[model samples]
Target: MSFGAHRPMSVLTWLATPVLFTASVLGLIGLGGMLLDADWRVALSSALFGPAAAVTVLLAGFVEWRTVRCRWCLGLGYPAVVFVAGLLLGDVTLSSPVALALGIPALTVLGVLMRRERNRVIPIA
Candidate 1:
């Protein structure tokens, strides 16, 4: 969508993206960690409110608007990349691959919603 076609997003909507994204990632990690008998709390909490999460959301938003030019990257692509990166970094395992698999589609849908709403210009009454 073009800038001219874009409407300003509410603060709640803006914040909700990261909040929901972070929550999904953490929930998956927690669930997987439990299944794997790993330390899910530390893994979940640390990543949830941590700087990394914030940075990730901001970076994804910027990248979506600038470079990627698509919400799929932020929603799906980012998680996929994160998943692969985690695997390469030994952060993900067969038992606990939540961020990559589950997070991708969830975030992708969210990104689509965010994109659609952001691009719509409501007629002034």
Candidate 2:
């Protein structure tokens, strides 16, 4: 949960999920609002928050690497969990079920490979 001061990561390992999760939700809201023409402010939020989701996720994944028991969960699942939460909270136009149905396996495989590649490159201590 704690990344000691020496490591110099922007977020704590535990906070990554929540930060990404919130960013996803807020980004969705901004995007939805922009598309709906609900408010001009949403445009800014969309620009700021949307990329934050990706950046935060990648930052957490590569820079602040942490291991999870399930590779499927590690690769595809974390994003899925936060994204689903985003959809629900932001009330985005995209259908969570439909997106997830198609995305799950592909992303899981990607995640697994990512771990495998890291294993080969980094090796376990």
Candidate 3:
């Protein structure tokens, strides 16, 4: 079970997942901010390059690695969670930063738990 053969593919798969997740998160937040009177550029800038975005991506990647062993499942499912989170939080005002801040970690953890439970109930082999 050498990881070498899968190393490149794994890295590539892992990288692509988070990038899209980050972008989707940022887009959602930015859209919310804009709806709340913030400049679109500022909102986008705040999300596109910041500690929060980095942390979200990093945490999501960790969840993907730990629970969703299949890269393809991770690539699809992880973003879907974030996507729903974003939509649910779409109306959150910018003043309430805590809600948005908590969403990333909360949803990431949820995805991890759900994936693990799924694997337990229905083992692949």
The candidate that wins on TM-score is: 1
- In model 1, what lDDT does residue 69 have? 43
> Pick by lDDT: which candidate is best?
1
TM-score of each: 0.37, 0.31, 0.29
Error of 3 at 68 (Å): 19
Quantify all predictions' global Cα lDDT against the true fold. Answer: 0.52, 0.44, 0.46
Residue pairs clashing, model 1: none
**What TM-score should be assigned to candidate 1?**
0.37
The superposed Cα distance between candidate 2 and the true structure at residue 40, in angstroms, equals 9.2
lDDT of 3: 0.46
Error of 2 at 38 (Å): 14
Question: For model 3, how does the per-residue alpha-carbon lDDT over 1-125 read when each residue is reduced to its tens digit?
Answer: 45422211234434444444454465456546646865433233333334433444454433325444654465455555555554554454443243356445645754664455445432345
Could you give me the TM-score of model 3 versus the true structure? 0.29
Candidate 3, poorest ten consecutive residues by summed lDDT: 4-13
From the highest lDDT down, the ranking of the candidates is 1, 3, 2
